[model samples]
Target: MTAEPAVVAPVLPAALRERIVAEFPKYPEKRAVLLSALHFVQDTFEGWIPQAVVPEVAALLGLKPIDVWEVIHFYAMFNSEPVGRCHLRVCTNLSCCLRGARGIMRRLEETLAVRPGEVTPDGNFSVGEVECLGSCGTAPVIQVNNERYREGLSEDDLPGLLDELRTRLAEQDAAKDEE
Candidate 1:
């Protein structure tokens, strides 16, 4: 026996719907647009892809919920749960590890007061380990919010880096509030 696919009503707003639809022509098939659609949906919500949007994306893309889930589950970029405004993904791949990635991870956990896979009390930061970010030349790299990378890290650099991130998060919050 199997559970029925969710009967998810359309939740995507007109703007986002248009954005996803606009990408249709660029792809060979509607199904091919799933990845971009997921990215748009995730960006619109938070850093993570909400479960509700999974069925929604499937419906819009003319695919099954399972199809969407497969992509989401396979991709490290798509978070199933809400992450902090600052999602610090430390690369623990071989090159980074050899270059002191573990020390960087420890410093981040200690400075943020949250272990990997946990959000801070203030909901401003979270830490997680990831595979190669493709910056072996700049080993010990940490990717922030999937947008920027700080490479060649040192334990001594942790304090200032964390402080900069905190300030940036605060600024982002303030800008959001102004809107």
Candidate 2:
């Protein structure tokens, strides 16, 4: 059999290494920490799991880098590239679409001035079309930053949501300025 090329692991910060190590005891095996480890690493990389991060995670969890990549690619929540500081994920599944999700998405595009999968010019927000967000009852749901989801959103609600996001971004910018 032909030998595979050696993989170069990247140097992760002490804190990140510690976080991954900390997750070890919570699971049955070291490899079980892969998901949470990916989350920690992704946060440190500014909300995206970069190619270099895969090998770093693998080295920490005693798995192959391709194993790490498999998890990253399997999950929709994981981003391979940089996304906006805030993600605007609108569910366009059967339930959401039947409930005016398309119109809501259109309004968001007009307001944010970016198409699906594209980040805004200022890096404040990005639009994405996701499948079911597991809220069929609340059809037409829009998730923000994967933190919260606003359900039953109508087209008119778009303006207020965008304004609120802009306000939050401004507040964040102001806080950063003070630091």
Predicted model with the maximum lDDT: 1
lDDT of 1 by residue, 55-94 (tens): 7788788999999999999998988888887889999999
Give the 10-residue window scoring lowest on summed lDDT in candidate 2: 5-14
**lDDT by residue (tens digit), candidate 2, 89-137:** 9999999899899898888888888987788888888988999999899
TM-score of each: 0.90, 0.87
Runs of candidate 1 exceeding 4 Å displacement: 1-9
Candidate 1 clashes: the total is 0
Which regions in candidate 2 have their CA more than 4 angstroms from the true location? 1-11
Q: Give the TM-score of candidate 2.
A: 0.87
Candidate 1 TM-score, true structure as reference:
0.90
